[model samples]
Target: MEYSKHNIFSKVKDSDEYFLLNPLSMQADILNSVEAQRYKDKRIENQQEYFKKGYLVDPKAEEKLFKSKYLDFIDERDSDEIQLFFTPWYTCNFDCSYCFQDEYTNPDEKVSDAVMDAFFAYIDTQFADRKKYITIFGGEPFLNTPDRRASIQKIIDGANQRNLDIAAVTNGYQLEEFIDILKGARVREIQVTLDGTHEVHDKRRMLKGGKGSFDKITKGIDLLLKEKIPVNLRMVVDKDNIDNLLNLARFAIEKGWTKSPFFKTALGRNYELHHCQTNNKRLFSRIEMYQEIYDLVKTNPEILEFHKPAFSISKFIFENGELPSPLFDSCSGTKTEWAFDYTGKIYSCTATVGNVGDELGTFYPKVDLKQDLIEEWEERDVLSIPECASCNVKLACGGGCAAVAKSRTGKIQSADCRPIKELLELGIGLYSKHEI
Candidate 1:
């Protein structure tokens, strides 16, 4: 296969037929190469810069470097250009304990009309000559609020009328009600989370009446299916919900979703930060969990066909020789898209908004999509950020989840890079055992 060794647009070259090298051997190649040495020197210089910026590193040693074009994908931060986000309203009925925007004023405070008008106007001016997308989000988008629903309808109507792409990230509570409204809305994708089964999910995500919400949610999901909406189920994997994942996967497949064109599975990390609920905390044993899931897939190949394997985890294990979270490689709100709150505030990722200091900026009047602001949002001086610069996998990780890194470690400079490194090492061993 032809590969670009570094940047995606770099010169493509052919290699003679040769045996596959394990990750360790590849790392050895990286360390011995002049290019790799230059990368290391640059990395050290960046670390000094990070330290000067008040970032600190842990006592842990850095992982060995590996050579893989996969890391290049993370570094390709320049591909996407245009972006759009639609916040229907902040009136979700279910109160997920870990919700970052849980503290935002309820429906009463949302500028329902102004936001809709501004969004439509913004879309007209901003999206006229550039590729654009519309991402629908909210507290619980399907609430009984007329204004919220109206705003969402306008965006949907506008997008459809203009032949624009649309996607929604919702709690799935009112999915059924909104299904009909969205049927002709030019929506291409929808993401909804199912943390676990009824028992666990109900406790963590309940209604305003403090009632378990699994049944209604399932009903709403069925409603979505009836409307033929393309959907991907996002599961927030953590210590608490890990054990039940296999069963959850099985349940989804049994729903005749195995062969459904819309079927996809997204594994998420549990950032156990303040105000975030931790009821089902012990979701996985990290490495052990990866092993279990991998073994399960090997044992039941059908599951892989039924549900798209969690691409993030699989990439970390088989490709990157690392595992940060199941969805580590996903470009949340940055790469292909971004998030906007009901109040018209823009963020790189929805999860990082309320937590990541004053780094986030407002998008009310209008924000330029062609500027370098997106990359600047998480800029780290490798010389200044000790942990990230010293780590061999920093480029691939981009310093890991900014939210989790901040919430858990109380800083944004250093994140938990150990799990990803270990997973990559384990993957190398597994591949060697299989003679890959």
Candidate 2:
């Protein structure tokens, strides 16, 4: 027996303790200095408890077991529920500086009855037997216009007819206007982005005519909560607006939104999943973005109320008292998710949906697929990615986002490596008490 390559050790800052996590073994412990050294030393026979817990394994057989477990994971996930995204059109009323869709998704393409009819008809025939749900995605699905509202009505009606509950990803500027239409389907949750407090947010996410959207958006949030519908408040943060998260948190608390069980928060870092926008210098690398949140939490602990990032594995361990199943592939693209647009085009997932070149095929006007491209997306996983083969945290990060991976290396199976070790080290300290 020998120490497993999958074991991860994170040293506690300014202390003699270390956190040991093994994704493969599903085991963890806080190791003191001697224990940490003992783990590194060739004294496996001295640690019977570790042996039983899978920290120690036969070196030759470990790889075979991992591959077997990975197959089980894929089998289970491939049989899981599907999430279907419907993009009505790419037209938007507000102009946000860092919106990734701005370059590819233009306002000229609008949804018509013919397109909606084709989309719903296609999904009904293709996924009639699968356990699936609908997600209304956009340029702006809830825009305040007769035609746009009609599109929402049809989408909600069609999803309801199929007994599929719905979620929506929207800007929330016209949420109040779409409240009735939104209620047409069994609403799961609505994701609305509010980047910062009123003053800060207005400058970045402004209406086409230069009016600030904070007031209208807040009013809409209040309306949704009153209607007993759930709302997830998302903040697209970058260096420019990251500091304002604290202020926004205070505002949410002041508004009593934190009191409601229906309210939740998510932080979307402004980074390149595709090509970047101008002044992309403000973008924080993945770890740097999380590191900023950690610093903000130290400045005012209440920032955690707005967002509690799962920093690798600490939050899970703190809650479940056990390691979760290994993550063989983090990207859900062609596996359990798909996106359709009014243009009759099909995309692998939300991030790459509207971008012209990323389209896998079309759903409307015809039912066709580029099987070669589809196979590439479906084949992404730790085993398929070259960089992940010998990596320590392969099972943890699961090769990261396939869209981001492809953007960087132009290969769907490449690794968009995550700083799993660094994040786990910070996460343990951040979530645990007394710095012990």
Candidate 3:
């Protein structure tokens, strides 16, 4: 018997105990100093208990287990659910300071009937055997214009004909105008972004003419809540808006949005994607963002009522009382999720959707595929990347974002691993006392 290659051992801060984590088995144990020293010296007292928790295993048996897990991870690529992301137009009404797609020119081109016809035809032929859903993406999908409204209705009508449910990510500027149409369709959930309270949110997410949008967006949100539509409020966090996070959370709670069954919230790091937005320097790293959030939660426990920050390791342990199943890959990319834009171009993920060089193929007007590009994205799992294959924290990091990897290294086959060891250490210190 030998120590498992996947075991991560770390000392618990300010305590004599240590944490033994086996990501493969999703098991964690707190050991006293004596017990930890014994395990380190290969003189464990309870061999049966160690082996049972996957801390120790026969070398031959370990090889078999690794092969099985890796194969199972790969097999998950054959998903039954086909998630299709459709972008109606590239024009957005808001001109946010840190918009990732700010570089994209707003062509304001309409979604022609031929484009819709081709989209449905592609879906019918390619995804007929799979369970399918439509995700309306944009340039603010809910633009309050007759042309945009008609385009949205066309999408809704097409999905309704096939009994497929729809979800949308919109700026929420014109959601009220499209309420009747949305109510008639099979709606799943809609995601809207609110940077902070009125003053902060207005400055960050405002109209192209530089006017504040807080009042309109709030009214739209109220309308959606009244209609009983599920809403996921998202906040893009950076140094500028970090101070106002608690304020926003408190406001949401006071307004009863947090208590609503149809409401949920998430925080996204405002980092650079394809091109850096104006305030790129103000963005926070993963570690920095989590630290700030941890501090916030410590100060005002009531904020937890509005949104529970999913701080990776701590969140997994809090929810399941064990480590999460080791991730073989972080993103779905081209395997499960595909993005189709207004011009019929297909992208591997939403982050790379409108970028010129990242096109996987064209699905409409003709079915032309760049097989080589598609294969690259499909094989971007942790095990496939050379740097990730031998890393101790590969399972935890899941090889990071493929688009970010490509942008940084000029290759999708590389990894953009996060500071997993540091995160694990932080999680151990914060959650050890709360462990079941």
**lDDT by residue (tens digit), candidate 2, 1-436:** 7778998886964457898888998998888878787767755445778777777888778888898888899889967898999999888888887878888748566788888888878778877777888899988888777877887888888888888889999889998988988766799899999989999999899988888999999999999999889999999988999989899999999898988999998888788776767897999888999888877887688877767888877778777878888999999998889999888999989989888689999987888999999999998899899989899998889999988888888889799999999898778777775221
Backbone clash count for every predicted candidate, in the order shown: 29, 0, 0
Q: Candidate 3: list runs displaced more than 4 Å.
A: 12-17, 37-43, 431-436
- lDDT string, candidate 1, 320-386, tens digits: 4543321223334455555666555666666654333523555565553524555544453232356
- Model 1: lDDT equals 0.55
**Candidate 1, poorest ten consecutive residues by summed lDDT:** 4-13
What value does the lDDT take at residue 93 in candidate 2? 88
Model 3 TM-score on a 0 to 1 scale: 0.94
Top candidate (TM-score)? 2
lDDT of 3 by residue, 215-262 (tens): 888788888889999889999899999999889999998888987898
| Candidate 3: 10-residue stretch with minimal lDDT | 427-436
RMSD after Cα superposition, model 2: 1.9
The CA lDDT of each predicted structure is 0.55, 0.86, 0.83
User: Any residue pairs clashing in model 3, and if so which?
Assistant: none
TM-scores for candidates 1 onward, in order: 0.68, 0.96, 0.94
